[model samples]
Target chain A: MEIIKIVSLGIVATVIIVLLKEIRPEFPMFISLLTGFAIFTMILGELSYVIETLSTLARRVNIEFAYFSTILKIIGMAYIVEFGAQISRDAGQESIAMKIELGGKVLIMVLAIPILLALMELILKILS
Target chain B: MGVVSFINSWLRDIVVLFILISIAELIMPKGNLKKYIRLVIGLLIIFTIINPFAKLFRFDFSLDKVVFNYAKPETFNSWELEEIYHNQERQIEKIYLKKIVEDLQSLIENETEYELVDGDISILKDEDNYGQIDYLVLYIREKTRNNSQGRISIEKIEPIEINRNLEKDFTEYNNDESIKALISDKYGIEKNRINIKIYKKGIGEINE
Candidate 1:
């Protein structure tokens, strides 16, 4: 998350779009799309690293594979949401952008629903 | 390899999650799905290229693995093994053994209540010369089980073995009562499920 990298990416994006806009208006959208993808990938790079580390850590600790894997998936969902939101913002559709963001967040929580339920079930069984 | 496969699995699972969500959204003449498809594409790029770079900067980018070797009674029975894995959900993976150990990997894979994905179990069968095993090898090719948080009832029935590394410990610690204890202890196996076989190294029968 270095400031320099982020700024450079933004500059590259702007330049790409600017160049693209001259050739064709629709080209700006495609250039922006590619630019947005590049930026999103840059951000996602962090998450993928995180996931890889988590898996390695899991192996190192000799813990259950499923447990950490679930955590990763939850984290992955959050990242996808954030990535979508940023790209959508770049696309300049605030309303649709929010929807993209909102969908990612809610879906992640939903993916986690089963785990949450299992935890509750365990607590109830323990108390009872 | 096990670690990479694990992350890839979760990423793949999320990708599938994206697809399902997109389908459920089912918006007429869906444009948003196309948009999400791009995000999915971005996710692949992130995992392949971006993620490893971050680890380069961190000093203590070390993650610890939980060891099944720590579980007591020399040889691990199923219940204790599962308990260990379930207890340390955030820390280690029991199935790392599953990746290498043939007995356990095949047990869970050959049949289980959970869904199977992205894991392969390769077992090299050993037919003993004097009705005794030469060498048995089980290689885990893939694993995507998420026992702690997922409802994937991965009934991983890893076959039991005396780890060669622990051979000395087994001889030193194995007294008559201990041997009996190994027999009597709960195996996390269902009732009437075990077939008893006694072998003293080669082909000689145990006379006791």
Candidate 2:
């Protein structure tokens, strides 16, 4: 209904998740997964619309489609890794979560190279 | 959305997850079901605290859209008369709609504002005509940049041939006799308790 409602639900879900973790640790992880999915389902319609509009705006600015998609990809990865990392910590494996995060950072850096190369080429031409 | 996600990039990780879950279930320290349930809940919160970990197993690649959606709606459910809230999910457009309508309604209903404030949402009819199967309309007025304003106006636009300029298909959330059912179904707020106020410029609000 409102943004606050979602927050409350999140809090409740978090509380439930915390209680779940101490006993059946596996169930806690499952609940975490389900909660992640539930939140996504809740806001899917809105995010889709925003992404669609942003894509349109990028097109209007004549930005390369590949460039735009790559940006979305990196963003998508960060979100997933972060979500999973937190769940790991909730499961009391903070070390595992940190490792997962490090891996995500590396991948993002690797994926960003093409964009950097494109920008460098543009700069060289401008200098010429 | 797919028949199979076989051989996808996350396949290895997903299989691992399935295996781990099964193992966790079998060897979960022989605790009470309640404790396990609590653990599940804890896992969820911990999961939220560190979101990026889930990314590794993600093949589709959009965790923000999923995780935030789950988290946001839970917060929104806490408001007074929340039952009256429609489309309770995290619609980004609703944020814009609510803000715009809040101003428009205040201006039109109060009438202190001299300038016209208008906001409208409509669901058109027919697949061939437009995708709007239903409609929502919102309007308001303003006298100046200052906060002083009039009562707001809002309507649900329909495929009516006659009322283009007229604010069509609108009912006050409170006091509208006709909207009793819709209000009951969409927002759980009672139809009678809500003190709905309405006003219009050239024409009055659609009561009948």
Candidate 3:
């Protein structure tokens, strides 16, 4: 079963990380990162299916494409930043993790600006 | 979101974050840097969790105009703001009232030396004011023995006290007369103004 495989991967990774941590402290981090990547890749299919379903549902509901795309971009930024920040932290580079998080925030804010401006303009239009 | 997708994405993030946090916990030589590092890590996790909800906050002016057309623009904003405020207020009131009920249940149980099985508190808010608690009604059930054959259940309704301090012992038992006397003595309200409902434990019948 997929569940059994994932569980085994986790257990195996944990054992390897623990053993490596005592003998070669530096190597455990790499093992941890690899395990995370492997698990993430294994579930890529399910994630894409969910995204596709949501997209079609949004289309059927007549949501504007701009808003939908901006939201998708924001979600993308969040995931990417989380992944990068976590990896950097695992490598014991706290400052680098913080920088990645800052970059993510700036990108999300940039992506949100258009929607924010559109809202402001609508408010101004209503007032006039 | 698919169950597998959620597990796949969040599981890895959780495990990685858990490992990093534990490492941070161990190797942190200084107390001050540790606090800042924790804060930064918390913020990163918060941003990740908020990713899906970012779409809900996206404002499309064209679509939102439908709501604006139904009401004056100024009133529409204020009305929406008020609705949000009221929702938050109600949630806080519910939580606070529940806490008070629990405290009161324990306090009454201790003072009366009786086991309280369950209790509920209902509060009336002032109509003219927002979030002001006006009056409280408490419904409490005693933990009675399970001697079903001989026990007669009586349902009693009683008014306790408005200004009676929770810190003081008012009524020791679930009796109507003592509670009314206590409320009248403590809050200076007339005995007629006070009402108490007394319920018999086993039968669960109303005592008129």
Candidate 4:
């Protein structure tokens, strides 16, 4: 199964990382980042399928494509941001990780602005 | 019943939206950013719930327009981006031309003793002089005061064939120059580009 392969790969990467920590401490960070990226790339196909299903469900339910698209963007942004932050954290750069997370928050806020404006306009229209 | 069907659809939409949000939450990375994401999720839920009600109330707001404006062009090629930019440029130019016409109409009616009936304006579409007024044609009629309150005097209807040139020259000399100068001062358009045609009250033909 794919899970078996993923698990084996993770175990092999962990063992290598543990061994490399003593000989070359800086090299372990690159190895860990490579492992994370490898896993992410492997699951990318499955992630697309999930997104496809979600969009189809949204279409079937007559949910606005705009909202669905916005949500999709937010999810994609979150995933990338999280991946970057984790890599930074793994490299022992806590400050860089925090900054990456802060940037992600700002980007997410930008994506949410349109939805917030839409809701605010709806509320004002209803009240008036 | 219609109400039953509406409620059914609305409930289904809510369920789907909830499922989608759940999926998003499941996939989301756990970190210090979780709370911010949760706040956005809360807003999404509220918006989805109230959206149908907004439609029912016939509110003029459209979320699609707002979202589309904010959306990034992830899938578009350079050609498609250029096409969209051109479309927007054309739309803005059309709107600008319309506003200029409206302003000119109001300016004539308020500042002069003529009522604007119809008009056409052309703008330069070249790269350098884009949006500049190329020519303006205004069909105006002299405003006449109401004779109902005062004594109505019977006047002879002038022959269209004979009096046309004289009437045209009179109007062109008196009103056209003043109007052209006014427009030139306001809009910076050349006086020769402004073509004003005056029509008398009873004349069915245009005196250019």
Cα-based lDDT at residue B5, candidate 3? 71
Error of 1 at A96 (Å): 2.4
Q: Give lDDT tens digits, candidate 1, residues B1-208.
A: 9669757765655555445334323421223334443443343333333223333343222121212222133333679668877788523333433443344334535543211121222222344422222233222222344464557676565444423332322211112232223323422332232222222231222221
Q: What residue runs in model 2 are displaced by over 4 Å at the alpha carbon? A: A2-5, A18-27, B1-208
Listed in order, the DockQ scores are 0.02, 0.02, 0.02, 0.33
lDDT, candidate 4, A1-128, per-residue tens: 87887888899999999998999898888887888888888888998999899888888877777677767877788878888998899888999999998998888887787678777777788778
lDDT of 3: 0.54
Each candidate's interface RMSD = 14.7, 19.6, 14.2, 2.4
- Candidate 1's displacement at residue B117, Å, is 39
Least lDDT summed over 10 consecutive residues: which range in candidate 4 chain B?
A: B158-167
TM-scores for the candidates: 0.33, 0.35, 0.39, 0.62
TM-score of chain B of each: 0.18, 0.22, 0.37, 0.53
Better of 1 and 3 by lDDT: 3
User: For residues B1-208, could you state the per-residue lDDT of candidate 2 as single tens digits?
Assistant: 2324433424443444344335334423231122422333233233322222333334332333333333324322466326535355335445645554454344444543222234444334455854321344333222322222554545533232222454443333333454334433543435453332233332332221
TM-score of chain A of each: 0.65, 0.78, 0.91, 0.95
Residue A118's lDDT within candidate 3 is 49
Q: Candidate 3 — which residues are off by over 4 angstroms?
A: B1-208
State model 2's lDDT: 0.47
| Candidate achieving the largest DockQ | 4
Model 3 chain A poorest ten-residue lDDT run: A61-70
Model 1, residue B166: displacement in angstroms? 30
